[model samples]
Target: MGGPSGASGTAAAPERRSGLNRVSQQRAEAEERQRIAEGRHSDPFAYLGGPHGPSRRVRIYHPEAAAVAFSEGTEVPRVAGTDFFEAPLPEALEAPYQVCWRDAGGAWHTAYDPYAFPPVLSEFDLHLYAEGRHWHAQRFLGAHCTTVDGVAGVVFSVWAPNAERVSVVGDFNRWDGRRHPMRLRLEAGVWELFIPGVEPGALYKFELRGAGGCGPLLKTDPCGRRYQHRPETAAVVEPPEAYPWGDDAWMERRRREGSAWQQAPWSIYEVHLGSWQRDVGGGFLDYRTLAHELVDYVQRTGFTHIELLPITEHPLDDSWGYQATGYFAPTSRFGEPDAFRYFVDYCHRHGIGVILDWVPAHFPRDAWALARFDGTPLYEHADPRQGEHRDWGTLIFNFGRNEVRSFLLSSALYWLEAYHLDGLRVDAVASMLYLNYSREDGDWVPNIHGGNENLEAIAFLREVNTVTHGEQPGTCIIAEESTSWPQVTRPTYLGGLGFTMKWNMGWMHDTLTYLGEDPVHRRYHHDQLTFGLLYAFTENFVLPFSHDEVVHGKGSLLDRMPGDDWQRLANLRLLYAYQFTYPGKKLLFMGCEIGQRSEWDADATVDWAALSDPRHAGVQRLVSDLNALYRGVPALHRYDFAEAGFAWVDCHDAEQSVLSYLRRGDAGEQALVVLNFTPVPRHGHRLGVPAPGRWTERMNTDSAYYGGSDLGNAGGVLAEPVPWSGYPYSVTLTLPPLAGLVLVGEGA
Candidate 1:
């Protein structure tokens, strides 16, 4: 053993040398620190605070010699003659403090750590109950809860100014109202409970035991469209994960195909899918049926896109879906959420883009899912002055709230991301952007400078555009605002809410009012048709014959015309042709292409029998041909606002009106549009042209295909450079009265 120890000692000699080297290194570091201090090499701020030092400082502002304070487990002294009361925070000399309280029995009862009450709850109605009071009898107006750390707890609060007691009853407590009562906190005239059992999808409601008996169970989630039980009973919906998208490749393909929505030549066919087609017995048309029939119909009708009315869930049977309840869920009445996905998928597959009609301005009260959610005006404005929408008898949302803003932004993204919708047609955008949008001075809220402009709502709209376009670049947002809000289609960063297109309401009203007049009187209104171009650049616009024009005692387009059946049809054809050739995009309501003669009635089906007639059939065919022409001619679909894309040939006379314009493109690609407003046909009309050569009639409203007099140029190039013409070239041709013609320059 001694010999082995001697050998081990010999082997440990090198290890001892290593240890001595470490000690020597430590001694040298100490000596170097001392030398640096002597030479003043160390900075005073070096150890004060840095990445390697303590980032912050702690200091006591005041210190007392001695003070009695309640410990964590100390029992709060119960005061007599008080059912609802608040316990004061333990403090001296107005210093910040914490409160700890326990029941008479030993337990970790209640504790408020470093409490600083918020002021936003000043206007809210709230109360607190003592631990021994009838907590079961308390009635809660609304309660909001969120998680802290890993424990699921709710900071329960309610608004019941008249209630003596309020307590939460839910599945977690087995519906027992008394056992799990809300503890009254420090706030007076308010009740609060820090409960740890409530979680997502847990069915709960406040049992309001008032001065009389228990009040009705009131639910939360006022903006919800679908509810399980009663109006006051809110359903605990399991938040749905974003749908797994299968159309990334399809989306990329569409991006490469160059959508009409992105192009200026956009022409949309506005549709109400439910009424566009129906069964023989007038039952609901399934989504698949609508997808197959409506998608093909839109494609064949020559429309570049299809804009649908609101497809969100609604309570009313015949609603246009404007009163949306389920912002996240598609209408289950039509089919599952996947059905809407398929419908959009079909449109994309068929080379047509789909646009959803989104309503975000206000919400209906009928939806228990959304109205008074959280038993208060949580989703809507807390103040009635800012929250109420008197025109529609609805509740306007508080766009200023971050959570509400996120909710709406997420809803829009859901459609664009999940359903593969190419765009959105925002309904009632005017109402969303103005405090006095549809109200008088007394009925609205004023801005900071006492103005009516809803700056918050406008800011929210900008945020919506930023979020939407930021997430998906090509997705278009179309505004259905009627007000003269300028630069709506401009970029959000430029003090404008970014919309891709806006409804041309001025054009629709002017054109419709003009068409209602006699042909003799129509000359005076001819400027109305062309006058829209002056303001066209304010925002990219879509000329729409929407449901608003056809519903609510407003007659159909055919009925609004000023003549007999044949003349009415001719006027309609002319109107359609003019709309197609106009400066902006076009959107026609369902059945309008084939001349539905009646107003749109939600209870009844579309007058499909109208299309059975040969004249109507011809109209449909003309529509098909028009779409084909639009797609074939790059000049018709190119940059519409550029000088190369538009040129006015004539717009002088109010009587015997005749306006001619040219839609020109790069490389001599052009289409000359001539519109005759007179009721009588004129032979050899000297129509002006840009180039002095030959021109051929490309599309004519007077053609037999669209039930016209067949007074059209038979695809023949006519010699130009006629005598006494202002333009470089002019061609003499017969033009039918109340007709529109598109003449293609030869080889253009």
Candidate 2:
């Protein structure tokens, strides 16, 4: 009787413990559902959907639905206190089962549960990304419309290592962050999710919840291939379609002539696409229209290449695409990515190379863009000294970070590979090279070696140049470097930054200053024009009259000349003639060719009406002839970077305000250039000739064809055997007022 009582008590104790365990499990489930409802659940996939427990029950969460069920007509029972419904796994349901829900409007919609799919990113991809060696990071990071396990959907990925939860939110899900939370890849800092039924053209952004009470940061895709037009920061899903390239011949030719661009003639027409021309309504023209119009204009002008001022996607029109927001996406202000492709393709087909002004120096501090992404300084450095450009009010990229390098490098290659651009002219390189650029002594942080040089940025530059050139042969990477940075255009293997060319800022400044002086005082400042030759061949240089020269209260090139109207036009012609004959490649802004009277305004088109004036038309014609001559003559362009190509015939004639030089080609071809800086004519000027022959006027800036006074050497001049100015022969010829001459020898 006693033993039976003891056994009953023990059984009662076991029953009580089981009851408590059931209550604890129920409470934990309730808490988990609460986190999911609040959008704070880090791993919603573990408990939200899929077969769980011995009963194989499937759970679904739909905040906007009135009722939920499986596609096979299996009704799911809603939990009493939550927006979740649960039902046992259906036998007839497929692997990616569909969940049908009735909305509050009594409309039924069926969608494949986004959380049902497995991880879309491969292990190798994660490994490479974490190691920061993902050269093609774009192939894995952006929203790609692809087929995963025979199910059509978009695989969205982003690098947000500090995020506790990241979601793919857009208008499809009512912009709710809780609708489709992504699964985090622990190995790498990337988050990825495959959302079925999401198609191309869907607008999306990453909604992130950071740790330590940071934020619910909503950010545009960093690697977005296409974004919506400005004033709206959402990224659009671009279809994964390869552009039909028709530049096979161009590509092959570029590859065959790799690194030979130095010897080639580069008469670049630097154009600001937005202001180069506009629609009749004064609005922006689509890329397709620009393709036909701009290409035709550049071709007719005889420019070998067109250097476009930054067309990368940016928000503010005032930034002129320099403060870039999207690196991979072409600015939608024109057209879709495919349309920009048409523009480049059209250019190449017409034998015109296109170079884009690429800005990797700094980025704008837009909230939806890269600034403080993941509620932390992810893409930029946290320290203000190293991370910020105070003058620009922009953030500098942390080149010291490996992932940042991957991002920037991938961006560079994407343009070359996807758009088939001829090259990139990197903007504001001086700022990137110096740690104290635009900074006070106490405001900037020095390097570990207490130096002003930014070693990390230097390394990044070298790496980018090496990677881009190695990947895309014949891609001419130029630097707009203003300072005396050494070896910017040399090979990286030789401890150089490895750019193809650099803009000659010193030449531009010195020549402009000299030309701005009056003729009466020109002899006192003659050295300004001759001083550039001292270091002219230090690097492969591009003589640029860029947009910088025609903006910010600095009037047009024509306005720089100090003379009467007639002499001003002649001086403008002389300027172009000097630039073409100079030992460098050429880059002239769009309006400069026609002698634009007003400064460059990004909001306005080039003053096409100026072309109606004969004086302006004359300048334009002179430019075209200069391009033709620069390309046709070997002596003028072949050895532009070699010391053997140029010789001072009579640089000592400063008292007469006259200068002369001899340009020599490798094959003994020769051209003599002589300029009279003053407005007075220098007739009977005994200029020394390199050879004893007839020197014909190839280009006379004072010719009547160029709005000049028709004062120059009559058709040709014969050099006598009289040694003068340390030459074997001499020619006495008429030098025009405020003009220059290009005299070619008969044998040349």
Candidate 3:
């Protein structure tokens, strides 16, 4: 064996060189090998299974597999030093076939081939999605069950245009992203994949690699209809709209009376579902149970609609669903998504509309949520000045992005179409319309024209309003815009925001401040009580004493009054009377009626035991009667946004701490509302009436039935021929201390 060079091993050099070449080839294949190992491959479908040399070739990636076999009489060869098992077929493979794996235990297993399916999303959907016109984007993007090529599976899709790669990782594949890298649809920047053997109730998450150098992001589906209980961030797969709706008659009525919502009585009872009477065990009440309990209460209490605080899925209990992570899902804290559907259905069946509080201004920047979604500010702006909400520690949406606008727009329509919601009370609308909202100098960025107005957000709002109203004829879109935005309730054709109504925030702030003052000092702020009527019909307004007035150390509505216990209750009664008789829609928070003494705590339930006290019970009774009277009397709600409906009888009585007004409705219906702020009843207080013979005392805040001093007005008052307050006829009556009274003409 020795050569002429004295056995220097030169004779076996060719074999050594050949081994070195194989090592070099294997080293280059390591990237292809490691991608299969780590699940970060961009195009898994293209490489995993494809046509090789005019015949079909397949790769089965199972690290634990001992041997791999196809059902079509083809045996796959396992690659040495890798988990991949590959095979070259003599003919093309028919889909819906099975793959058998013999694991280390020597037992055989079978499952359908995941690669046998076609694309779940169509190309036309991509075109609409790119233009921000896909109102039903939720139906296409979220996880859905379908059959492709005779193979039944779950199709997973998401919009992650800026991601390098996205994968569906879950318990089925041992949380491995490399196992199911989704195929990217480049036109819409959406990634989708169909996996066989995945069924409903499976927990899943997206494992996404960002376009730049950054860590991967694990996120819940934004359009997920259901989620696991909190502290578990995985999205639960479920079929949509499985609940059988029983509101056909209600929907038919809405179609027939298309414009009834505009002229109807809208006394909304705003409630926080978590804190509004919890279960006996101190847990949250199920949506189904609340459907029955809340429905009966709203029906009996005479509230036309129940406006719920945001029920969208959120991580923290303290946020009360405002910092929502799941825009489409109903929080599982109460019940399943179907249960929430039942809640809406029950409201509709019983003649009560449900208005959900929708928040699109900003979202919490939790690691598992939409913040830096693709690890590169995909959902938000890259600049902190434009994206971050410093006040709330949240992230503002980049409305300039078409996909982002489409996402939010789709959410608004989804509720009205899927859940049958009558309206959406868009929360914090002022924050959305202003680029400098709650910001100091140099802390925010200006728009394209260097102004404070968020132009893109304005355009988005117009689009949402136009589409929602166009699609749903009778649907209402109320805006909780605290600022005096111009023409919020006007149509978009007139260059307005096109809202159904805007909350009268100035009225709420001024009146609450005035009520908090001592009665002796109330005379100085008499203008505060009368200033709202100056521009009362500026926009279709809603006089709301909402949850914001009773939280965050502001104190409860009853606690806001500056008086002794009796005076406080009396002031609250008078306040309620004025609100009901005011010329606008009405919304009252839950505990305001029963007089909850403390600020609202989202964690705790209402103090139901307070009802044992007669004072609290009386306030509750008064609210019920107010709603009933407001509904039965046309003068209270008819032509609420018109100038002819109201007139100031006396706006300059600051010395006496008194104000009086007259309201007129269609059909010559009329009423007089008078209020005395001080705790001093006035005997024979003369006020003018339009044309009166006998005036029946409709409601008195000082009635003995409402825990007030039964002051001196005996049921009715007759007008005298004496001229008073610039009118031909005047009614002389007693005005109760710290009270409001409404009187209707018996014969005008």
Q: Best candidate per TM-score, number?
A: 2
lDDT of 1 by residue, 378-490 (tens): 56897878998877888998887554565676678777876788888988998887888777768877999898888878887776777777677778888998888888988
In model 1, the runs with Cα more than 4 Å from the true position are 1-246, 254-261, 723-725
Instruction: Give the alpha carbon lDDT tens digit for every residue of 168-192 in model 3.
Output: 8898888877778889998999999
Tell me the TM-score of each prediction against the true structure: 0.72, 0.98, 0.95
Model 1 root-mean-square deviation: 18.7
Worst 10 residues of 3 by lDDT: 49-58
- Which pairs, if any, clash in model 3? 39-178
**Candidate 2 per-residue lDDT over residues 228-299, each given as its tens digit:** 888998999999868898999999999998978878899999988899899889899999999999988888
Q: What overall lDDT goes with each candidate model?
A: 0.65, 0.90, 0.87
Error of 2 at 396 (Å): 0.6
Better of 1 and 2 by TM-score: 2
